[model samples]
Target chain A: MRSSYDVIIVGAGPGGSITAKTCAQAGLEVLLIEKRQEIGDPVRCAEGVGKEGLIHHIEPDSRWIAAELKGSMIFAPDGTEIKMSEEASSQKAGFNLERKIFDRVLAQQAAMAGADVMVKTRATGLLRSNGSISGIKVMYMGEVTEIKASIVIGADGVESKVGRWGGIDTSLKPVDINTCTQFLVSNIDAGEYNKFYIGEKYAPGGYLWLFPKGEHTANLGLGILGSKCGTVRPISLLHKFMETYMPQGKIIEMVVGGVPVSGPIKQTVANGLILVGDAARQSDPLTGGGIINAMDAGKIAGEVCIKAKEKGDYSVKILKEYEDRWRATIGKELSKSLMIKNLLIKVSDEQLNQLAHSLSGIDTSKMALPKVLPILFKKNPKILWELRTLFI
Target chain B: MSVIVNRYKCGYCGACVGVCPAGALELVETWIEVDNTCTSCGVCAKICPVGALVVIK
Candidate 1:
């Protein structure tokens, strides 16, 4: 690796790879680093992405897709199911992907775009120049190497410290943190629509989910609020779902991870430093969906960073454009999702049961949240009044 | 006391390491290391995504 570059992105996930690809394609020297020996091994995500947000950026690749989905089923604690209408769910078509393969392909694209790529290179800390980031200190091939850059993109995952190291307060409230565990089980019944289960019994302060990867395979997972999940382990909750829902399922693989269901932080850019993906908490606060948003931020940041490089200014003033562009892009929806997540977790299971009952009688698959939420809680005026921010 | 890691279950995503108040848990890309500073507060165990870290209180 060269001693320095124009951009060095930590973590070769979709966000990092895309940033590297976009900037390198613009003729900037870029380097992408992955801590794992393989680019996308030990996949920790549910691997679901919407086609509307994804297809425009990445072409349809059969090698990375496991299943295409039309809609989803929302189940309440009482086993009542609300099948989203095909049209509504079709508005945002979904896909269950092989993230391990998908991530590697994105990284390879970055390399093809002229970015240097390295696996098993761990970023240990930031290199500070006058209280701002000048480069990164990474353990590459078991040797500490200081690589300098005009810009650094922290595409690290949810537990990323690069934001913290860059003077951004990345602290999360317990309610904002979700402890997630999943099992990829095979030889079970899989369906076209994804399924979601909500209740304290399933996942306190969160929900349980099943996204089908194939005809007889699915990724079953649950996330619970860190504060609400006192003494309750996510694995036990996942196993309970296995026993109660799919007793015949055979375990194929296991993944454990955290999702920052919180909204984006106060700021994502500092002097010569920008945060992307989970590092920036760009994931949807309600569904923990992030791949598209992360890539969105990466694409925007690449453009803004290139502008800054061309002008020979890497200060916070120049970098703030990334934050502005991202906010104008997907930031509003993410903030709304945070509000929705907070309200859902605060409500009781009985209310959720009532919601399921109400929805079961109507066709809500095509309706958006503003149109659907009021009906879901029509009986509870107090709750609706409290959530007026979303509707009104 | 420090937290114990279950090799069979840990995904090594480092959620426990990030939440450690004592700064005792470290994820070195391959293995998790617990230092002598651990007070066994069990925050790491509670915050562990996979239930791999355990505090034997």
Candidate 2:
């Protein structure tokens, strides 16, 4: 890499790659780096993305679209299922992707847009000049080099150190993060609909998910709240779950990760620095889905960054535009999701069973969270009274 | 007491780094490094999805 660039983006995930593509296409000098030699090997996510949010940035390709889900089924601990309506779940209607290929394609798009792509280049610390964040200190092939930049974007996933080096707290408590483990299993009856299981018996503070990846194979995973984890880790819990649920299935691969369910951090920008994707905790607090939010934030950051370059100003004032724009869009929903997640954790398994029973009579074709939550709140007011704040 | 990491099993997902209250864990792309700041509280061990970490006295 050269001694300097207009923008240096850390991490080559959806967020970083999109930002790089946008900025490079806008004629800015951009360098995007990935710590790994490969962009997306050993996938850390469940690889699901909503079609609408995804198509907003890039067209779908069969090479990476593993499965198209019709809807999702939520199973309470008692085995009562709540099937989301086609239209309602259509909001979530999307594809299970092969992230190994998907992430590479995104980075390739960035390169095509004229951004420099470097792999196996890890950012070890931030470069500060005269009390202003200027660039990054990176280690490549065991040689550390300082690359200067007017702006740095931390798109570096959940174990993000870039944010910390730039003085953004970015720390997560045990209760705020989910320790997740997933397995790719074959020889099972995988369906078009994704399945979710909830309650302590399944995941305690989190939930279990089965996302089919076509051809009788599926990604089965569960996340447990870090605080709730005991002698049994998520991997062990997942194995036990598999024994009871998909005994016929044979495990093929394993992936482990942590999702920040803490919503967005208080601040995502420091002078001359910005954070995106999981680095900024942009993932959904309820669903742990961040690809869309990350891309959305990256788009906004790109715009703000372009404006900053044009004005010849790279200060917090210019970067705060990104913070405001993302907060106006993704932030509001994330806040609501956080409240919901907290409520879900507080509600007992018995209450969840009751909720499943109370909603059983509703027509599945018309069932949506907006409609179902109100009915649930009305029926279980004693337990769900806190939900009033969300609707109100 | 300190934390031990099973390098072979670590996916380097950084789940342990995020939950380390002492900020003792660092993800080095290929592996996780536990620093002296670790109190051996075993929080990272508990949260390691692959069970790759342990608190050893």
Candidate 3:
């Protein structure tokens, strides 16, 4: 392996791969590493991505698309369902992806763009020189080797060591993390629309999702506040949910993971090292999804890395530009989403049922979730009074 | 890279070894260890049946 490169990315997930691909395309030396034997395996997500969000970063490929969605169904605790049409769902109604294929495609794009990819390699530590990141220490095939790089990008997911090693505070409070469990089940019948179930009984402080992958298969999952559900395994909760909702379905693949429901980290870059994806807590605070945000952050980080390379400056001060740029792009939406998440958590089951009823037949085209709050409140001013606290 | 496996939470199902890209994970006396070349990708931590593995920097 070469001892040095212009850029070294720690993970080959969406964020890292996109950064590497972008930099490589700009004629910079880049190395992308994946700790897994396969570029995409042991899928950790619900495999859902927004159509518009996916299109914003890279062109969609048929190989990765499992199903295209038209809309979503929102269910209250009492099972009252509110269906939102595609025209009204905005980009929030995205597609259910085949993550294995989707992740591999991103990594392949990076490799094709001249980035060196090393699978089964782990970045163990940061190589530092006088308090600045100079390179990385990697363990590959039982041999510890040091690789030098001008810039290092950490796309290593929520529990990102790269960020910690680089002296960036990536710690997430228990309240900020959502424990998620999902299963790919067969023999289920659900509409083309993705379904969301909300209530403390279903998933306290979070929600359950039923994403149809095909006519007979779907990814069924739920996320709950990590701190509130002490010692209750997310997988067991998932089985309970499945038994209650689709008792006859057989689970084919089980996936357990955590989603960083926190907003973006205060700092994403520092002196030759930058963080992206879950590592940077770029996932949606309300929905606990990261594919879109990760890719978006990756693109911005990649662009910034190229500029820094050209200017021969890899200082933290120089990289702050990347953080500022992304904040301008998606930061506002993330903050708004976080507020919604908090409000959703505080609502009672009865309130949710009422809210569903109010929104049932309403046309949502050109309207966002927040915009619908007032209309629901008008139906019962008491509920509106209780929810008013959220806006403040 | 070293991986600390919490025996209390580890089911030893070997999912970590199955998904490890570096082939640096294995069941040793009912425990998983970071082989000499372990990359610390935390894939093992991510795939562990019981969330037993925690990667420390």
**Chain A only: TM-score per candidate:** 0.96, 0.97, 0.94
TM-score of each: 0.94, 0.96, 0.86
List the candidate 2 regions with Cα displacement exceeding 4 Å.
A85-92, A366-368
Task: Name the TM-score of candidate 3.
Answer: 0.86
Where is model 2 chain A poorest over a 10-residue stretch in terms of lDDT?
A84-93
**Which of 2 and 3 is the better model by TM-score?**
2
> Candidate 2, overall lDDT?
0.88
Ranking of all candidate structures by their DockQ, best first: 2, 1, 3
Of 2 and 3, the candidate ranking higher by DockQ: 2
Q: Write the per-residue lDDT of candidate 3 for residues A1-392, one digit (tens) a residue.
A: 57899999988888898899999999999999987778767777888776778887777777788888777777899998776544453444678888898889889989999999999888888998866799999888878899999999999886577887788776665567777778888998866888888898788888889999977899998877765554555567778887876899998987666777777668888899999888888888888888888888899999999999989999987899889988887787788778777777888998888877877677754454566667776776776675565455
Model 3 has fnat of: 0.01
Query: Which candidate has the highest DockQ of all?
Result: 2
Off by over 4 Å in 3: A85-93, A365-371, A377-392, B1-57
- Tens-place lDDT per residue, model 2, A1-392, is 58899999999999999999999999999999999999988788888877778999999999999999877789999999988644564554768999999999999999999999999999988998877789999999999999999999999988888888888888888888898999999999888778889999899889999999998999999998887886767888899999987899999999999999998689999888999999999999888999999999999988888999999889998899999999999999899889889999988999999988987677664464556777788777888887789767
The lowest-lDDT stretch of 10 consecutive residues in candidate 1 chain A is A84-93
- Model 2, B1-57: lDDT tens digits are 678889988878899888787778888767888888888887788778878987986
